[model samples]
Target: MTLTKQHLVNTFEGARNNNSPYVFVGIEAEGIKEVISIPSVSFDAKEQFYNNAYSNKLVHVMNSKVKIIGLTHGYPEALTDLV
Candidate 1:
């Protein structure tokens, strides 16, 4: 199964709040995807995806103390260039 925008948002939100830097991402089987923490990098949900998939959810995300840059789909190295 393909990961939906909502799934990515939820995963990002959870990882963001806990100050996590990385999280494993997969489809269909929840157990297949492991949540891993990545190093912290300055990120903003509104600025990144305001006009994209997160526009409607911007207000809720703004309340989060931690910054969310992007959702992880693979190993930590794959996310290094994203930050």
Candidate 2:
């Protein structure tokens, strides 16, 4: 099933609250839709990539329009699930 941005935000928030590892992976909304991954911890960086702004740092740089396609707890799971 195709996931929405709200789903991504919700998953991110839930993981944060539970203190569990999370890695959000998705592709660009347009063009070739290159795959990219964003670790939950990155949100806590000084850049504040996870700011309330819809056009946050990760989206602005990694993908103009990121469509979260998969979520996993840590790299091992990401590798197994996303692959």
Candidate 3:
């Protein structure tokens, strides 16, 4: 099920703060649409996964209707978009 608009904010908060391999931005037509501003995978200080795609694993959680704003990939060209 799609999360309510408010839940989108919560989900985004978690993702933005995450220091994991990848962050999932929750889009509910939300309040601020934040990108991961914190330190990432030792490449750049502000290289967020915004407007991109992730592994097929993410497809499980993202489903079809969900709109992705970022992705982390082994092959950068593999992803359709990158933000």
Candidate 4:
């Protein structure tokens, strides 16, 4: 599902509160539609990662406006369908 900023914030908070590992995959809201990964973590860290415009472990997009399209919990089973 597409997520707005507030939705993103809430999702991040929920993940953190539950101490669950989640990996979100999104595309740019505008041109190029670059793909990116939003790893579950603190809001500050997510903001930092967004601002930095880079993902060492995943694809990077400059000034990315992430629109989450999918997510998976951190576990082999959770990734089976995705893979």
What's each prediction's TM-score? 0.34, 0.48, 0.24, 0.43
Pitting candidate 3 against candidate 4, the one with the higher lDDT is 4
Worst 10 residues of 2 by lDDT: 46-55
Model 1 regions lying over 4 Å from their true place: 23-39, 45-47, 50-83
Model 1 agreement with the true structure over 21-40: per-residue lDDT tens digits:
55543211222323334334
TM-score of candidate 3 to 2 decimals? 0.24
Worst 10 residues of 3 by lDDT: 42-51
Tell me, by lDDT, which candidate is best: 2
Residue 23 of model 3 has an lDDT of 35
For residue 68, model 3's alpha carbon misses the true position, in angstroms, by 10
Whole-model lDDT values for every prediction: 0.43, 0.51, 0.36, 0.48
Off by over 4 Å in 2: 28-35, 44-66
For model 4, the superposed segments whose C-alpha errors exceed 4 Å read 28-35, 38-43, 48-83
Clashing pairs in 3: 49-70, 51-69, 51-70, 52-70
Candidate 4 backbone overlaps, count: 0
Q: Report how far residue 81 has shifted in candidate 1, in Å.
A: 17
Over the stretch 30-82, how does candidate 2's per-residue lDDT look in tens digits? 64544455555674551244334324233544456654345444544555666
> Candidate 3 regions off by >4 Å?
24-83
lDDT of 3 by residue, 30-67 (tens): 33333332323532322223213322322224444444
